[model samples]
Target chain A: MTVERSAPPTISEVAAEAGVGRATAARTLGGYGYVSPELRSRVLAAAERLGYRANALARSMSTGVSHTLGVIVADIGNPFFAGVVRGISDASRARGFDTIVLSTHESLDEEIAAMHVLIDKQVDGIVVASAALGPKTSAHIAEAWSRGIPVVLVDRAVPGLELDAVVIDNREAAREAVTALIAAGHRRVGFVWGPPIAGRPDRRRDLVDAAARNLWTDGERLRGYLDALDDAGLPFDADLVMVGEKTEERAIAEVERMLGLDDRVTALFCTETDAVTGALRAIRATGFRVPADVSLIGFDDSSWAAVMEPPLTMIEQPMLALGTRAAEVLLALIDGAPRSQPDGAFRHTLDTRLVERSSVAPPSA
Target chain B: MTVERSAPPTISEVAAEAGVGRATAARTLGGYGYVSPELRSRVLAAAERLGYRANALARSMSTGVSHTLGVIVADIGNPFFAGVVRGISDASRARGFDTIVLSTHESLDEEIAAMHVLIDKQVDGIVVASAALGPKTSAHIAEAWSRGIPVVLVDRAVPGLELDAVVIDNREAAREAVTALIAAGHRRVGFVWGPPIAGRPDRRRDLVDAAARNLWTDGERLRGYLDALDDAGLPFDADLVMVGEKTEERAIAEVERMLGLDDRVTALFCTETDAVTGALRAIRATGFRVPADVSLIGFDDSSWAAVMEPPLTMIEQPMLALGTRAAEVLLALIDGAPRSQPDGAFRHTLDTRLVERSSVAPPSA
Candidate 1:
């Protein structure tokens, strides 16, 4: 299994062979100022002979900027992240910056690895859309900031991080979606929730006790749904709630099990597009017509939502805007602009609109 | 809108400010071989005052290697490419290499842009899955070779380019699929062909033109179908032929239009999974029973193909193997290994297999 190692030679070796002081060899090999042609030739030849390659990390330590940006996402397979990546790529290209994209897959270790990679590469800035931030990940980003590398949080915000961020108002968007469903006459609505990992420590506690107290996005959304229900004089039914894993198959199975209950949900509110798709498939399998046997509403208006049979009623989040704004902020930081927020907590809240489609209707009698 | 530019300081200014000869300043700032500590300190102080950053591209030209890899794909949105990219990332990460991924969007200009970016970045190597290559693109890769940077062609093999490549036998796979259809008593068969584009030139012309000449994979598959038809005394009819753009919408539309023809197609063979999905949608739309009214077969046994309703019968290409092999070849080239082939054209073709499922059956009366 062993392949020939193609590792580049070390700087010390190149210096020794170049027959010059280490400092002189370093500067000449690195293409820094003040190297004569003869010395430059000697150093380059020696370095080439020794296969010495310049280390970008060391170079970044000397210079304030690395001309590289780090982009971290929860998952690459999700078309949402893919679209955001496209936007980042376009923006970064326009700014003549290169990006190092990493998929965290919702793992803290992976997120940490991504941060380390970016730090090692000495990226000028970092844009992250994490599931949640661990203390270590937060510390790593803070360290990079101390070294003058700007970090911009995207989608997921880490509380107390004091970094610029671009995000949609998830709680407001969710509440609006739930309010719409309630307005459409859904009395008994079930919810499919996302993983309860909060990005900030202050928010983490709220998320942990979300079932008891109002969390940021999820709790606020739930409160909105409840408020709408209360406004309609409908009692909130706990039994109607179903929590499922994010995968389509698992979500569908959870929905099927929930539906088999004695008093099944009359309508459903999917917290994410994946949940929506899964619920639809399960309902279809049971021969239930959308908005007939059960009305449904979903968050995140994904591309496939419009193409699905009966289409889909969804709350659309501005994914591209979020990505573009994050890039702009990072570029601004790279340009040595004053931080937008004195507290280092810059946030942008985008409006979400509900797209009414055949997937939602008054609950059937 | 005009944005403020934040360009880094140049090396020449750093040398002048350091009060040293240009050669001395370069040697001191570059951090490689030899310089007095006093001279190094003065050079560093000057560089810090002026904010000088070395030009990586120019440095890469003088040196032999750049610690970067370029990756080009026809379409990043395709789940297949996503899977391949995942493999590439995993492999590249294990070796501590950074990759710059580019999407061609099936356009030649974009593909050329990808090449130019990699060249400008002075990347150590490149891996590409091109839509088509003109002389210019070929020349760029050859130029990289002359500059001692390794290039590995992935999926697409250019015949004229003396480079290493990883690919699958598309024709043989197609033939196998058609042969399976023949085995299942399908005679009046039709094909949904891939778009006419040469992603690589070194590939056998017959294979590349299989859909047109009906010679390599496309042709061989057609031959297998023809053999089955001739053996069953079923004359090949051109009326059943349908060509579709790469999109599922177009494929479905083409299939629907072909079904409206007088003769009608009894069985279908699609060249790609997207086309197969489209054909299935069309068949369902027309209320036709799969494998009963019109049997079907597809290429590229995608993850969803097997999970679809009735499951798909398809030819499976070794996707992960293709990616891994391409990486291996590029890594080898980066290690300065001599070309395996004397003429410098190295190509490896993996086998493809037919996976039978519920999609194919004899045509109904």
Candidate 2:
């Protein structure tokens, strides 16, 4: 049998049922201009009886406020993003706003498409964990800003775009993690995961040149690794660093290569979750033990990290707080709050915590 | 300085620029009906020059097809739901649809609000992992159905709703897990998670009564536990069961109590992610070694499960497949696919796999 449905009741019908002018009914139902309490009650009662649900699209078009927040994240499946989205959604809902989430899956084309869709849908604001590396790649985001749709960046920032961003001090966090490794007598430390630059960086200058072409976060992290090496008065060795596409398989291969080197890395500084997993898998396959043959430190403390064989020391980014603060900032902007910065960009950097577990130790003699 | 934004360009302006009639421009720009190739190119180029974006809301209102999907999950932060949402989003995007995700945080009031918001937004269809357990609690879903909006359930099913549902055979999966524990020579096994029923269930009949008030999935799982007990010619002992709010803290307290029992359980079956974490914490706190003191089985395999000291045996649900199939079915329903079931409710059950790792062993004599 076919499903039969009637057309939704309109404002005119509700007004007729309530014995009030259409304007009064529209004002009451649309929640716009003033209506007397008695007339408002009649209109609402009429709407209830007639089952009149306001057309959110039409209402948004008329008022120019959809009361909706759109989020464009790289991957909703990642635990980091999952936590952030939860924070954003919770805050948005508490503020009487609805949220529309779109995952880009780390594709620039998809990110562009998502931005256009959110704009066309007239979302009041957008919070993005951009996969974009430069201004040209983030043209859609800039376009959104020009269109008066507020955009807030999370996790990463783009150069040359003046907008609000919520992020952690990636450079400082990375330096501290790597510095701890160095202080533990790990002269030969391997860095895994970074921007996928073309070819390998054979020297320190090569890395410096590649930094300008990668994600701002990755560049900061690479610089932090360099800072630690420089502070220890150790010469940079290309063989001890793995910087490229961060797939687990690629990480495993690069780590194994480092392990097989004549001057093998005695410790590892993994910059991401997948990097840590890959390094552990490689160590296991190569007949090495964590914190024994080689000590390790990873970014992103996760549930699994606590339950690992010897537990894992990690740098925990405040993912939930990042999302919540971004929403708060964006909502304030939408509410006509003045920018605190002269250039119209507000950068909020949160602190990361280092949780020391069983994964770190002095390098084996 | 203040931001100045111009009003968006209109279709009429686009038509004028393209030197075509309003109808021709509308046909070309709206992607409806037909337009000549020459006129289509002109309208397209003119629209691009004007930087015009078709109002997706208006287009949806006129066409009655939003080309959007709305997803309401219990919690997007949960890895299971996160994976499911990614699968749904990927599948939806491949089919040229955008998805709007909302998290209810397991609150029925929020679920109802989310349903109303999605309906008001005029999404083409909805896929929900409903937090509502009964007909009364799910009136919004039924209302959406009555309003000619199609909805597909994921993860959980409502008892009286006649709608498509995608789920695993939770009962069989639970029974398989429990039966494995029994076969391993553990006579006293504790079931660590289920629906929140008031007061204590002192006998097996009370459990049967409580099943009617809980979630359908929980009821099935509880029945599966009972089936395993019956099959093994074992008496149902209320002391060996913990059924309530399924919170991590609650699970920890309950498991600790079980561990303190005079006739303590030799094995435990934890039904969810939080339950597993809580059980592990309780065992560690009580100084009870895994396998040696209490064998354990858990549901939902995760990254940490593989890296745990003794690892974890888990029942792995096809979470991603469940979401993909839900979207496929909902899209089909939206596209006018006929229901194959006589009752107009199509149910698809995916298989669950039992991954045996190092967590289970014969209980100590």
Candidate 3:
């Protein structure tokens, strides 16, 4: 090999400087097979002195451990995902690992591509807030697992996948939020966001069927909304629930149509940040007042929520905790920890807190 | 070598199945040395049939190109950086490249460690919003460049480093914002969030000296503030400037202190998101009204700013463009494009839009 002092020092140069065999130096620096303590120290010291850094790819190929975690989220620009990524990065860094984050823009095809990339890179583990919902859609994830790279799901869970998951009790959280609206004497409550249904639901069964075919979180939250209506002995009004693609523009149009109905929605339950913002904009455009003409409750509290006209009452998800727990679980699996439950999965259901400010009140006459 | 049917296919297995030599298979699959079109197609077809995937680590070692990029930012949780990352990720994905993101929390040591990790990963290039300042603090970046991995900076630039940088003209942005406040007939304008300095400054020279030792954006913005004051022939009042750690609590406390000063500040210019939030909270807590009691102008517009009681006027940064331009420059470099400028560096200065809302009004006597 050519000895070029200007380029980064090679392993052979490090070995020569350490007065050890190249094989020993490779084993010590690559963190694979055994090397005597003395020889390891000598090689490490020589590496530091020569500014020699081991290539992670070569090391990963030999040891099957990249000391890196891969995270795939829907969109990193969204505040919720941003917080979750921060938690995962902080937790992973503290545990002596690096993280690679990829955003799929909620596309299944992109998610598949990202999964393939992660597997090719040989990450030690993965934490995913998956866009895939069922077994067929999640074949890429299963392929990664079969290759021995464990994956931990966060924010959402997939059916028929026996893997550790960190998520909030979406059903219970939605139930509690809707129950509060009912307790405030609201007979007509609107659900502003739900699963990506193909058409508007004209009956309760339509929602139930759509939920079954979509994401686990969406299905659970829809059930929670239905539960609250049942608890109040109120009939589920299909017109009061917004369906189809959950976009801000669609949310505003749907909310406007609902408000203009012969029987108006007395209050609204929004399950996401964009939904809340869209709802507020619609309310303002329709010349309605909050907690007076229409009471509102939203999910995912932010700094702006606290500074709104009357402030906002929100259900705050444990976003950071979800991310931290996912990383921790993935790291444990990477260390060869056995699954604790009989189903061979670790289900960590975190709690969400209701922050009551001034936005919720009795429905106006 | 022994082969197992249950395991992922190996290169050797692909070579045997394709009726080619091992070296030919390696060259074809690893995307390195040239192979005849006939043999290359045969190897690729065989690999596809056997579900053989190329390991990025092994391929990178052979070809010196991972087709991946590394990004280092202050915090992924922050809205500004979140938008920037989204742009970078989207742009990189369009070019068929994967990105690895890391957050430094504005810590120099963490930035250094992140740089080292990226180098070891053998990424084709890096895009960074650096936490390092002068040559002493920026040695790690230079080292990476010298080793053939190009780095493109975004958001902030470092002095004495000849490298491509994507940034807004921060000095001009701040100057225009401050000039707007002055045009509103406000002479005593408070400048919130400056460089992190020790002890309170009693003279303009103190701030000038501190700027030289801190971040490039901070220094430029500070210079712009000074420029606006000079244009109005207003004597620089050190008492109106808030320095040191730019935390939310400090911003609130300093604004409160400024309002209570013998020569009260008639308007406030906040240079960051947190500063604006803190200033608003302080104004509310002090029983002062925005615009009527004190006019405000802030940097970095967000959705919350538009939804405020009286919509805020802000300097809207090209956050996404910054990331996109940085990625484009880095990609060009990775593709061996020559620098356009004679100085051997690409300096992309994007413009900022000044969105005038209802936040500014004539200050009350």
DockQ winner: 3
- DockQ per candidate: 0.11, 0.28, 0.29
Best-to-worst order by lDDT is: 3, 2, 1
- Give per-model TM-scores: 0.68, 0.85, 0.86
Best-performing candidate as measured by TM-score: 3
CAPRI level of candidate 3: acceptable
True contacts kept of 3: 0.43
Q: Give fnat of each prediction, in order.
A: 0.04, 0.42, 0.43
Question: For model 1, how does the per-residue alpha-carbon lDDT over A1-365 read when each residue is reduced to its tens digit?
Answer: 11233644444556677887666675675555578888888888887777665554444445545566778887665656766776776688679776557776666667766675565455678888854443434766665564456788887666656767677766666667777777877767776653333331233234335532322345546555666666677776554554334577766876776677787777788876567767877886777777778888887775345534556788887777777888888898889887657675678766678888778788776
Task: Tell me the tens digit of each residue's lDDT in model 2 across B157-259.
Answer: 7766777889988889999999999999989999888557757778777775576465677778888888999999988888888866778888888899999
- Candidate 2's C-alpha runs over 4 A off are A1-51, A208-214, A340-345, B1-53, B205-214, B340-345
List model 3 lDDT by residue over A1-365, tens digit each: 22446657766778898999987876676565788999999999998888885675666665556788999998888889989988898899989998888888888888888887787777889999987777768878777775667888899887667778899988999999999999999999999886677677777877877875766777888899999999889999888888878888888998898899999998999998889988888887898889898999999998778767778899998889888999998889888897446574558989899999988889887
lDDT of 2 by residue, A197-296 (tens): 7578687777755764656777888888889999899889887878668688888998999999988999999988888888988888898898999899
iRMSD value for model 1: 9.3
